[model samples]
Target: MTEDFQEIVETFEFLDDWEDRYRHVIDMGKTMPPLDETLRVPATKVDGCASQVWIVPHIEGNGPEAVFTFQGESDAMIVRGLIAILSALFNNVTVQQVVDTDAAAAFAQLGLDQHLSAQRSNGLRAMIVRIQSLAQNKLASDS
Candidate 1:
């Protein structure tokens, strides 16, 4: 949801420093519901991440209006926060919306790109690509 991203931006704007923001992000990760153990398979695992990450996707509805929802986990706390942020930003939205959404822009708005290491940033991009791939696959199936 765009509003959700906006809210996140506004919330982070109030924090005084990057350290505070990082803590807020880790707290956000804590709020995410734990991923089920069954979904933590190799196929669901996101490669290119320095940390172990697994993502599970479910598509709801049909045709252009289908919504792509995701659940994910990571072995690292920071990566878990990244996964939580991605899930919140992309989940329960239309397939076209998911494809069109600019996650980089949101990450930029949050100043995440500046704060992250190169490897972590690459992992984040990998996660976004995975989400987009899921949406594209659903669109093809609906067609």
Candidate 2:
């Protein structure tokens, strides 16, 4: 649903080495504006991650047609970069589209699933689940 996500895929394709891709992910995270400390509440806190992570959803408009966007942060640099990647994955899309997206496939395309630690992969799945849950909730309210 976002061109930025496609751009990420293309960028990943351009980077041949894992180390360069890793740095690129970290650099992507560095570019993200920090999430507000006050917003890092228990409600936003993501479990199942070794690193502390928070995601706050911001939905605009009503129902399935609503836009889905979120602000996320993580204590770990790599996790923060993953959050940036997720932002590119889900931001500014319709709630319905968010619910329908194949996030695992997208990440697999980026070859992230093969490279990430098991814990990090689980954490990434957790983040995607959280985002999808938010979108589902939006759709439910619309119905």
| Candidate 2, 8-88: lDDT as tens digits | 999999999999999999999999999999999999999889999999999999988899999999999999999999999
* Model 1 misplacement above 4 A: none
In model 2, pairs of residues that clash are none
Task: List the global CA lDDT of all models.
Answer: 0.88, 0.95
lDDT tens string, model 1, 11-77? Answer: 8899979999999889888888888898889999998888999989988898879978889999888
Under the 3 Å rule for N, CA and C atoms, how many clashes does model 1 have?
Answer: 0
In angstroms, the error of model 1 at 43 is 1.3
Instruction: Give lDDT: candidate 1, residue 13.
Output: 94
TM-score of each: 0.95, 0.98
Worst 10 residues of 1 by lDDT: 1-10
Global fold similarity of model 2 (TM-score)? 0.98
**Which one is best on TM-score?**
2
